[model samples]
Target: MNATRSMLICDDEEELAHELGEYFASLGWHVALAITAEEAIAQLRGGLAPQVLITDLRIGAVDGRQVVAEARALPPALCPALVIIITGHVMHNVTAADLDSDFLYVKPVDPTEVLDDIGSFLAGVAPPPA
Candidate 1:
């Protein structure tokens, strides 16, 4: 069994958030779901520091960049090991510099690819072969 890693997923889309949460949970990861940016920030400030945080860029109010800023503001040991931003508005008013994330994925992303990246981040190694 894999070591139990913790993850925080913040997405306004209920279906996608739950899907990602379930997938990570199945991989032996403890997952937390936040549907709003405020909730996501609250989780971080309330001592729910996870190894990974995956958030949607355009969540209602506060946005993912704010969430990342909040996470980064935490003490080093309390910060997430990786932050990933996902959004449908890839061509919208967003630039790579604005992301401030370890990885960014446009919508319609393959969950498996995200899982692979998560595994790699946690393991501190390259992703496994397909």
Candidate 2:
């Protein structure tokens, strides 16, 4: 991960969220793990404007796609949060043209690669170690 860029690991699965958050935290990202869609929204409401938002496809009642839409519906400045969609063992073939996400990957994703992708777009946001 870039020692720059605030990131959020959003998934209803607590264990999975912690695992991903820990991995990115090791790389020096200011990462927060959210176990529900409401929590994710609360984080944003509390001024945690993450540059990158990583979420699971099937997150309990609120799926990743819906999360993106809700997050985008926030203030204009938060409209284009770079989203990384995570899916299960068998991910649905969703095209980029069909969604407004930066990328999508099936589990188990490589933490290193995820870091690289976030780093690629991090212009100046410093990643604070959690």
Candidate 3:
């Protein structure tokens, strides 16, 4: 993967966001952290284009799905290569049909696993089986 690869992580949990940001940064990725959906949207609108975006499904007032929509609505050149959605809530209300994210993960997920998946994607390799 290119050392300049960048990712955006949006989560209301400050500690988790910071942890993921630091971990990806350590891996030499340009990591951006957003604590709110509004902030995440602002970053995207401000022309911060990341290759990957990982966001919690339920941000304060706006949903992560909204962010996905906004991202997808951007010009082709500005769209993220992948979108991963994370949430602690039950799967009842959330469906892939609604969000159209490349992947969806429940809470308590291993950060390294996420990183590995992302690395594999960027390296043009298939991700290992779960």
Candidate 2: 10-residue stretch with minimal lDDT: 121-130
Model 2 Cα lDDT, one tens digit per residue, 1-130: 4565567888877888998898878767778888887788777777777778888878777677777777677775654347888877474577644666778887888877877776675545443435
My TM-score estimates for the predictions, one after another, are 0.88, 0.80, 0.88
Tell me the tens digit of each residue's lDDT in model 3 across 1-130. 5577888999999988998899889888889999999999999999988889999999888989989988888887777888999999879776655679877888886888988787776677332222
lDDT of each: 0.85, 0.74, 0.85
Query: Listing every candidate in turn, what is its Cα RMSD in Å to the true structure after a full C-alpha superposition?
Result: 4.5, 3.6, 4.9
Q: What's the distance in Å from true for residue 32, model 2?
A: 1.3
| Candidate closer to the true structure by TM-score (higher is better), 1 or 2 | 1
* Runs with alpha carbons beyond 4 Å of true place in candidate 1: 92-97, 125-130
Better of 2 and 3 by TM-score: 3
